[model samples]
Target: MIYKSMLLVILLLPMIGSLVGWLIGRKSEKYRDKFNILLTAAELLIISLMFKRIGVEPVSLFIPDIMGTGLALKLDIFRYIFVWVTAFIWFLTTIYSTQYLIRYKNRNRYYAFFMLTLGSTIGIFLSENLINLFTFFEIMSFTSYLLVIHDEDEYAHDAGKSYISMAIIGGLVLLMGLFLMYDYLGTVDISVLSHSMKNIGSIKYLISTLLIIGFGVKASIVPLHVWLPKAHPAAPTPASAVLSGILVKTGIFGIIIVVGVIMNGDIPLSTAVIILGFINMLLGGFLAIFQRNVKRILAYSSMSQVGYIMVGLGLIGLLKDHNAIAVYATLYHIFNHALFKVLLFLCAGIIYMILHELSINAIRGFGKHKNVLKVLFLIGLFAIIGMPGFNGFISKTLLHEALSEAHHMYKTRWFDVAELVFTISSSFTVAYLLKIFITVFMEESEEYRGQYRDHLKKRAIVPMIMLSVVIIFIGLRPNVILKVLEGTMELFHAHGSIEPHFYDIKNIKSSIITIGYGCIIYFGFIRSYLRRRENGRPIYFNPSLRWLSLERHIYIPVGRFLYRSSSVVFKVIDRGIINLVIYLSNSLKSLSGIKVKRPTRVIADLKIKKPKELTRFKIKEEHEDITKRLSKRSMHKEFVTFMDMVTVLRRNLNSLMYAVFILAVMIIVVLGVLVF
Candidate 1:
């Protein structure tokens, strides 16, 4: 109970602080900023304590009969690692948001949603059962949507809509998959089922696929990844950090829990996981290489990183005791990726804030303006590129070890495919990350350099420096991370005594190989750079072409065709309604055709009663005078002109009122919504 209380407090503190900060923000910016800092500190402290506690003893807390979840929470080895990562990244993002959100006017609202997302994300990691995980997962989605649409621009709105729509669909599918799992397995606990039951047969595979797709939306797997580029660029920079750095991992976490824990080691399932992961790796990398927008390019790079994690995880599923090694690799990559990705994003934000531009072309000589940032970004670059000392090297090496060690377990053909894809992805990753580095620091653009140089602030330097240290620390002594990884790796059955040559921990040979290849690539890039420099402008390559993009070729076209089809259907429906109205009016006219003749007998009676003798010539002269007066007046023509004038004025007045009412309503609604 004490542990549970502490865990819950750790999760909810940020949320409480965010709300309090939002309320106070209206009164004082000083107080608001202080609240944010305080909340962040508290979160850091709590997470540190959690790490200590989990390190001492693994704890599991279960609350039965809550939301049909039989609410279960655990501080297991796996979650402990994930929680540590989440807390670290969350803290950095909070610090980043302090400055990032300041650019916007109503910053309180942004901070509120930001903290809300943090709370929900924490809950997701802490939840023991699938049901509770889903609940928090949904809360994270909806609140994160608010962050995505924070800019209130048309593009942001559209992206938010797409993101939510896809998320909801994914959530529903996830729920269905979970319910099915529960019906068959009688529980949705993270622990693997002890024995295979009759109820969970072939359907287990189907449900697993559905669940993967559901989580894959957030994971930003290819074909379902349209929202990632749109959402990240639209979000505030700090929010973008969390979205890429942490949020996507929740999807991966879902996959980890479901496939790794629940499925209890199915070979075919693992194979499928590997195949999809390989595809995502290649697809995400190639697509990222083409993007000119800084954040969007980073966003695509995130998908590629996700792909790396997936490949490691899927490989874990394939081998018996090797899943532990894969998990270790996944964890290492997760940590390394978070550090570098956040650094890059925060650096991008600082650049944008200082320069007010988002294009890479605009930041050509960025390295010259902010030398500190250049150094920081370079550290991130090295880490991401799997330099010998960086954290990325540790994970990639482990992954390579897992593959090579499990060579005997996996089929030769598929194993070769995975290896080839991994190698190619690494090459492509180097190309893009270096391309970004070169574009910003090495390129020659005097115009952007001049404009952005003056806006660099000391306030932004701290976060960058902090992240830079982390990247360097992890890079230099990967053993520091490997020690942490071994704790969790002990849970898997890594039984094969086949100590492959790849597991050789000798640094000198690997360093020589890496340096040799890097020199070659560097020279090749320089030659290419010289050629482009001489030619005036560099040629832009499309990465999406290399990996078949469903967005351009399939999704967009299918959407267009659907829109056109819907429009035609709507037109047909409208025409039908118009025709029905016309028919109804005609029917009414036909029904009222009966007419009555009036007063003929009354006129004759009146004439007979007034039977006095009259002169015919006098009567005829009077009738002629009356007929002449009527002819001169032209009553029909006057009536027609008056009716036309009234009709025009009536239509103009109706339209004018409609326009006024619409404008007034919009004004009120906008005020009410934004202010509220």
Candidate 2:
């Protein structure tokens, strides 16, 4: 009984706490910051206490049936894992934000949305039904967009637009897919859907595609990833940390539910995921290589890393009953990436907070002799680049081995392509991390003479140190994470059979090779070919690659086309075709000799009729009822009135932003009926 209430508290406390934080935030930053930290810490304690109570069997808390559908809160081994992951990160981010956002405007608004999103993210992890997952997913999107647009600058607004637009498009696509799912399956419960999904046949593929594309916008799979790179750089540091760290994983978590759980390891969809994932990995890494903004580089790296996670997920489907290794790899990497990525973003935030600049050329020697910041940055760097003793090395090795096993099992060319791309992308990851390190931390004093203040507050350093310590602990004793990962196999319906070995000869050799390739790319090409010395300073020379974006080539054109399409659809199909149908119906009735009148109720007994004043057409008389009907002299006035109304609507229609709002509301309502 106690355990059940704790689960609800874990889900709702952050939300409740965030509201309180907002109210007090207007008073002072100290009051607001302390309130949020306390609330988040309390939520973490609740989650911790519930940790032991969540047994092998799933525990569910139910709300009353809402319009024939019930809301559920289930704590299973799957949700349990992410519950801890999210809370831990949120707690750290809160601590980091306390000092980082000091004196920054809108602290109240930032903390409010921050806490709200924390609750929404946990809800997403704990949801037992798709309706519940999506409900929280929408809340998460709305709250996080506030974080993105918090700076209230033009860049922030632009990124916010892209972020919200992608989220809405994804939601619509997902709702349409889910409508078909609920119509055929009769339920949105994962446990129930998992049992029935096998019988849906080809419909499952369409459903899978829609859900993937929908989630892909957030998961940031290639072609659907234009918003990610933009939004991360625009958001404040802690917000950016969570955005890249955990928000993206919520999308992967949904995909896990669909492909790994509900769909029962659908093979065809798995292949498509693998193909799209490989493309995303390469494209993200390629773009990251040329970026000048440190934050954007990290953002693009997130896309690549997420693609790697997707590849691990795809491998799960291809491996079948042999899916244990891939499942472990994917889950482990999700946690590992969240840890290192958050640390890196916070470290970047510290640099930004101090230096007020983010370009590689702008901050050369930024970490000079700052041992704490340097060491902290290196820990994340090594972890991200897959150093032999870091957390990333273990996961990437497992991921590579899993793909290799799948390839060997099938003897197919595609798996070979997967292996090759994974290797190349890994090398690129090393290259960029090395580039940052070389530019910011490793230049000789003679080469770069400028230096800035490096002394940092303990508030900023503590959270990063905590993250670095965890990354190293896991890197050294990976069995801890490997054990946690074993619990996730039941969710994916896989064997927790194979014991993972991180320090083996094969793993070590692969790490060495990947790191060596990364060094070569950094020193040979990036330093010499892509950068040039101008007036005794190093300048990045890859403007072509930096500006060459999918936004210009693909997303903008598609967005414009969609806007134009909606107008054409409204004028030509909605009004034009619908009006034509009514005309045809009336013409058919007349031709068939059936008198059709507008259906209405009128008095048959009462003798009410038009007044004589209305019937008398006295055009010269001022009281000719010209306001009620168009008398001959008032024809021009009536035409002018009608034209004014039409013109007003037409002028407003030029904006078309309302169409987007209406379309979004309509989709939500439609999905609401299917769920609630």
Candidate 3:
């Protein structure tokens, strides 16, 4: 009974506190900040009290009258991990935000949504019912949208537009899946659905895809990730920290529930996830390499790191009975990523607070003399790049082992290629991180040297210090987390043990190779091409700026096309009805030898200008054609030169289609073999 009450309190405290904090701030802002910090700390303490219950019988509270489908909350080792981390990060960022936002406007409003977002995020982790999960999921989305646009600038508004738009669409899609799930199974309870999915037939694929996409939007999987880069830079720093650290995990949490819990590791679904994971891994890291904004780079890094987590999730399915390592990798990476990624963002926050700028060129050498900030930043950097003796190394090494285990078990060439991609993506992680470190910290600049030496106080620095300590502790003693992760396996019904030899020579060698690749890429390609002399000073440029944007080119154009198509259909229908009316009127008038007066004016009243509309469609069609030609030419210039051997294949349309057909056939064969 006591535990159940605490569960309710844990879920509702932040939400209630959000309102209370806002009310209190109406009279006093200082009290509001302290209240929020204390509220978050209390949240952490409450969740910590439940840690002793791990591996014991899970605790659940069900309220049947809420949200029309009841509110179901559960506490198990799996959910506990996320809830505790969310509390811990939120508490620290709350403290950090107090100082970070001191000079910014609308402190009270920020705190309200900040705490509100925390509540909803915690709610997501605790939801045992799919509907309950989504209810909180949408709330989190809307609340965090406020956080993203807290600055209320044009950039923030634009980011907010993209963020909210994708979120609403993702939610609606997710709701559709839930609707289908309930219609078919008569329940949206996860536990019930887990058992019911096996009997769901082929329709299960459609349900899972909808759910994955709904969750994938938040997970920032490729093509669904356009909002993330913009949102991070536009949001306040503390918001950015949690956005990358905790919020994205909510999406991953849902996916894990769908894949690991409900579907029970369906092979086809797992294979598709692995493919997307690899795409996210490579594409995010590649884009991060060319970014100029620190937050944007970190945003892409978050996407890439989420990819690593996704790959781990997919491997859990591939490894089957021996999936313990992959499970550990997935869960442990979630924990580690939240720590280091948040730490890096907080460090970036400090830099931003000092200079009000995040461009690498503008802030270069600002950390040269700031030893405390530099060291804190390096800890995050080392951890992210998978340096030996860091938390990232532990989880990344486990991910590598999981991939290797899959390769060994199947002996497939596909796994071999995945392993190669995994190694290369790891190198990209190192390269982009080092790019930030060297350019912003190591490189000397006359303009930024000796600036803002003592701008940060204990309030700001302590949170980062705490995060760094946890990161190092976890890195050194990974088994501590691994042991806790072991408790989660029963939830997934996974058996066997994860006994990763963290310091094994093979693992160390893998880390060294990845790091070496990163160093080579950074010093060789990035240094030579990305930076140039401008006005006798070095400037970094983002070549990806010219690259095709998923939002600008794909999503917007498709939306316009749909809108135009619908408009044309409606206009034609209206014109047909009007012409019928005109014909009848003319027949009546002809009987009296008096034509309808001002017939052209009547037609014009409908506002369906045929010539103008036709011209508009023609112009749009021509524009699209030109855009496609430009995109193809850019692609040719950028990549075709590197693949001279494929020149003939590129030019021959028939040959390209043949290659695609063969690839499709190969994939079908692979899937068939895996399924059978």
Candidate 4:
């Protein structure tokens, strides 16, 4: 009771206190900021106190039937650690945003939504059942939408449109999945479902697909990641930090719940996830290199990082014996990615605010005189690039080793290829980071050097410095967090026997190899031709747009087509059937009443004239839509050939289909032999 009470207070405080921030902001901005900072600080303190009470077993709170479902909340070791992370991050972002948002309007609205988002995110981590998780998930989504569109410009509005579209579609699909799953199981209890739903037949596949789409949109894996790049650049700096830093992680958290628990770590499911992860990783890394906008690069990078985490989730499912190590890697990377990615975005925010520009070309040499921001940015850069002594190094190393172990256990060529792709993506990562560094920091632009000035103050950088310090500290002393992770690993019954050799010779050598490849790519591509040609010349590398944007090529067109097609089909089937029934009934009544004139010929019957009013209305409001006619044409220009795309999809889909078909055939053959 004591633990539950304390836990409840920590979870609910930020949201409830948001009212105070809102009310205060309406009356006085200063008081609102102070109140928000105090609320975050107090929430952190309370969470720490609550953390002290959580043991091996979880502390639980149960509410009787409400909202068509029961509310179940628990504070286990994992939840406690995540809650602690949430409070800590919320506090830091609050402090950072205070300085970041000083010049922006709606300071009060931003602060209010900020706290509301914070509370809902914490609530997600604390939730013990699906209903509880989704309730908070929705609140987090809607409140965060406000944050995304805080700027209220056309760009913000468009980005908000993209963001909300994905969110609503995902949420509705996820809701249907939840309803189906709960109807089948009669409950949304996490513990019971993970343990019992081992074989729900083919419907499990449908449920799984729904859940993945629901969560993957936010996770931004491959075809579903259209909104991230646009939304990140459109949002305010502080909101951008939170969006990349923590908001995406909520989608990831839902994914973990679905894949890890609901699906029971099925091998086929895991394999499918790995393939998607690898695709996103490659595509995101490939796309980031082409981007000039600093925030868009980071947004794409976030997509790839989520890919890394997804890979770990897949491995955990595949290697149940070592689920602990895999789960630990996944959780650890989520934390590190949040840290460095948020820091990177915050750095961008400060740069944008200081110079009133986001284009790397425009901000060239801005970091030359700003040593502190430069160093902090480098720390974040290195952390993300998996440099030897930053936080990302630890998580990346663990995942690489886990992948190696899984490869050893199953020595297939596909695993070998997957490892190769993962390795090269790391190289691509280095190439892009070098591009950002060289363009903004190293390369000199005389035009912008004179125009640009350092405007970020000391207080604005407090968050960056703090994050950098923590990242560096964790890189050096990973055991500090690894110890907590190992405990959480125990709950999953995963193999987490840590050894010194992990960070020793082999992994060190591996890290050196990755960096060496990165170095080669940087000089070979980024430095070799692109920079060599850019000395007071009109030379720019053309980033081919044909395959660069999945959203444009696939997600948007396909999504709109499906939406329109489904609407058309529903209208035709439903309304057409009703209208036909009405016409037939009226004709039958006319015949039965003996009131019909001599029967008209078939041609005459079919040629009934339109109403005079309808004909006049149609002619008066005539419209022409060239684009609609264009859609009737071939979808692709010569460059965007349809057969080419179909061929590629067929190739990839064939491999997956072959695997499933073979697996099914094996099951069938075995069943036949057994029955005979």
Candidate 5:
């Protein structure tokens, strides 16, 4: 019963906070701060209860009768993992937001949207069916779109528009996939279909593809990730924290549910996911190395980190051996990614608020402004790079273990390529993160010093402190993350037999060697390659550099061709449209002026030879109408005179009476009030 109540509270708490925030936040600006505190306390308490109940007992709750739609909410172990990550980050962001959003206007509106997005995110986590998940996913997408475009700048608006367009398409594709899935399987419940014992056709592969592409757009996979860097940087700090830290995880959550729960461990589909993850891992890392902006680099890094999570999911789904370890590592990395990613984004926000600088080069010596923040930033960086004794190292090691186990089992060339690619990607991550650490912290000069001296604040330290402690705690004792994830992975029971040799220590040692080689490549090849000056100075490439040759070669010709083509097309279409509109207007005028009767024939019949005679004839016609009316009765004579006195009113009354009679007869006939 307590667990049931907790589910209700979890669903309703954000909505209540949203209402309370709107009701009171606008009248007093200070009320916005109060709303944050109040809502955070309430939310934290509810989430604490949920964790306690679920962590201790691990119960599942279902309500099948919702709105008579056969919908249900589940609090299973898998959902709980997402719930924990979202809840912890949301709490920290709330504390951070209380101080962060104070300087901005329209505090009330911002908080309201913030609360709405929280509710939507919680809905996504709690949804038990694909339809419900898609519904909540869209809500998460659009509500966050508002937050992204909140600054009302041209860049923000353009980014917001692109985000919505891509998100809507992704949602529609996901819906199509869900419909096809339900049509084939006859159910949308994730748990039911996973164990349903049905023969799936080729459409299953199509479903997997659609779902991956649908979710990959938000997960920031290559080619589909164009909007992420633009959207994250345009949004406010807290929103960016959740967007990077939690929102993208929803896509991973969706993939896991579809593949892990619905497909019942389809290895072929799993192989495809693994390949996509491989691509994401490499492309995300490669692109991140080229970025110069601080948040943009982190944004790209997010794509890469999510790539790691995808790797774990893909491998878990693929390998028959060590499947449990794969899922455990996936979920563990998911939590760690959220914790450290948000820490860095929030810390960057703090720096921005203080220095108002976003470029890495612009904040050359930000380390001098606040020593504590500098340390926190370094810790967050280390966490991301998988430095020893950080949370990232543990999960990454498990991922490598899983990949190694899968490689030996498959022994295919593709597996070898994936292993090599994964190792190389990890090496690049080390090089780029070291570059970030050095550029931000160690490199300093008179020009780089004291650029951000005025923006330091105690309020910014709260979230950093909380996140730093959590990262340290998890890093030192990774068993905490692994144990929780282990509890979650037991639900997916693989049926294949496994040999003890699959888990051999020799293979583990071999993978570690690859990792060592990766590190050496980072230090030896990439580090030296990047550090050496091209022309007696360190080198950087401009984004516009690729256009130089094109500018000299093809730009003028392409521009002239485009101009000529557009001019031709516009002229032709413009003439046709103009002619069409003119013809239409002339036809309307002619129709309006047209008369059925011939006025000349009437005048000839009247035989009016002169102007005075024509006037006399007009008077006679009117008198004739009066005489005909008077011939009916003495009362008719009085009515004719009254009509003559108010001619316009008489005409209007006759038209209105005719309309009313028609309407009355139609209504009566329909209702049988009067018979024909």
Candidate 6:
């Protein structure tokens, strides 16, 4: 009972504190900052207090007659992992934001949303009911949207548009899936649904797919990931840290529920996730290589690292009873990623705080004399690249082993292909991190020498230093987290024990080979083709600017086409029906022996004439006048007025219409499948 009450407090504190902090800031900003730090520290303390309860029975709270089916919250070992990490990272980033946001406008608004997002995210992890989970998921989306647009510039607004549009679409799709599941299975409780899912037939696949896609949007899966690169760079650095490090995991959390708990290791579904995992891995890394912006690169890196986690998840399904290693690897990577990615973003924040720039070309050599910053950045880089002595190496090595196990068991050519992609993706991770480090730290620039030396403060550096220590500590002692991961496997009904030799000869060699591939790619491809000399300094360029964008070329154009096509179809149908009705009325009057009057002007206009006749007779005079007007005036001015109207309507209504169109199409497809 005490644990359950604490659970409610943990969920509500940050939300309540958000209001209190905002009110306090209205009086004094200093005390508000302190209050936020204390609030988050308390959250972390509460989660840590529950650590001793792992491997025991789970804690749950049920509130009936709320949100339709009521709200259900649970805290098992698996959930505890996420809850603890969310609290920890939020605590650190809140501390970091204090110094980082000092010079920025709207500090009160920023901190309010920051803490609100924290509560919402923690609520997502604690949710035992799908509806409850979605409620928190949406809250997190909206609260975080404010953080993304804090800058309120054109760029930030653009990013926020993409972020919110996709989020709303994803949320609606997720809700549809949940509605269907409840209708079919009679409950939305995750535990009950898990068992209920097994009794259903092939419809389960449809349900799971909808759920996966809904979650995948948040996960930043490819094609759905158009918003991430733009969003991370636009958000404040501290917000960026948590956004990349923690929020994407909410998507992953939902997917795990569907794949691991609901599906119970369904092999076919797992195979599909594996294929998409490799695609995300390769695509994210490839794009990261071409990026010149530091935050954009990190954003893509988040995508690629998530791919690794997804692969581990797929392996768990593939291995069935012997998925212990994959389970451990996935959870551990989640933890490790939160640590290092947050560390790297904080490092980026420091640089941004000092220079207000994130472009690699613009900020080259900014950290040359900043040894403390350099060391901290290196720790994060090495961890992410899976250097032998860091936390990332442990999880990554385990993931490699899981892949090997899958290959050995299946012995199929596709798994062999997946293994190659895995190795290349790992190499790409190394290439990009090295690109950032060497360009920003090692390279020499005359413009930034000895600039902003006094900007480094103890408050800013302390959080990163603490992160570095944790990374090193976990890297050295892999068992500390491994034990926790092992205890959570029962949540998935996974059997077997995880007992990999972390420092084995083969694993070390594999790491070295991946590192080697990265070095060659960096020196051979990136340093050569991606840059050029300008005034005796190397300037980097992104070739991908010319590449086709999913949002620009595919999604938007497709949307416009649909809207135009639908408008034309509806117009033709409306006119054809009117003409048919007029003809029928005249024929009925003649048949009844009444005097048949000449056709009315409205009937003649509505008459369905041949295309050329209609054009020649009806539009001929208008066409002639239009041509004369065009000849008398400049073409640009004549067209600009019409185009401006279209552009305004599209700019204002495109996102909402696109979302509605997608929802409509999804419903049509589902209905067609069901009817057929």
Q: Estimate each model's TM-score.
A: 0.78, 0.86, 0.86, 0.84, 0.76, 0.87
User: Which tens-of-lDDT digit does each residue in 1-676 have in candidate 6?
Assistant: 8989998999999999999999999999999999999999999998898877645778899989988889899998899889999999999999899999999999999999999999999999999999999999999999999999999999999999989978977887788898889878999889988788988899899889889888988999876898899999999999999999999999999999999888887999998888888999999999999999899999999999999999999999998877888899899999999999999999999999989998999999999888999999999999998989899999999998889988898899988898899989999999999999999999988888887879999889999999999999999999999887777878778887877788888888888899999999999999999989999789999989999998888766665666566656555654454345334444553455333232221121111222223231333343344334434522232222222222233333434545555555555433332222
Clashes in predicted model 5: 1
Q: Which numbered prediction scores highest in TM-score against the true structure?
A: 6
lDDT of candidate 1 over 194-276, digit per residue (tens): 24432467888877877887788899886677789889998888889889989998998888766666665567877777777
lDDT of 3 by residue, 1-676 (tens): 9899999999999999999999999999889888998999999998998888656768899998999999999999999999999999999999999999999999899999999999999999999999999999999999999999999999999999999988987887788789899888999999988899989799998899889988999999877899999999999999999999999999999999999889998888989899999999999999999998999999999999999999999998988898888999999999999999999999999999988999998888888878899999999999999999999999999998889889999998999799888988989998999989998888887776666877878999999999999999999999898888878887777897877789989888889989999999999888899989999878889989898888898776666555565556555654454345445434543454432232222121111122213232243343344335434422122211111111122234333444554454444432322222
Worst 10 residues of 6 by lDDT: 600-609
Which portions of model 1 show Cα errors greater than 4 Å?
Answer: 192-199, 408-411, 448-454, 490-549, 556-676
TM-score of 1: 0.78
Alpha-carbon RMSD, each predicted model: 13.6, 7.1, 14.6, 13.0, 12.8, 9.8
- lDDT for 233 in candidate 4 is 94
Q: Which of the two candidates, 5 or 6, achieves a greater TM-score against the reference?
A: 6
lDDT of 6 at 614: 24
Pairs of residues at least 3 apart in sequence or in different chains that clash in candidate 6:
none
Look at candidate 1 and tell me the lDDT of residue 364.
63
Candidate 4 Cα errors over 4 Å, as ranges: 446-454, 529-542, 546-548, 559-676
The residue pairs found clashing in candidate 5 are 354-455
Candidate with more favorable, higher lDDT: 1 or 4: 4
lDDT of prediction 4: 0.76
lDDT of candidate 2 over 257-279, digit per residue (tens)? 89888888789888888888788
lDDT of each: 0.70, 0.79, 0.85, 0.76, 0.69, 0.86
* CA RMSD (A), model 2: 7.1
**Model 4 quality (TM-score):** 0.84
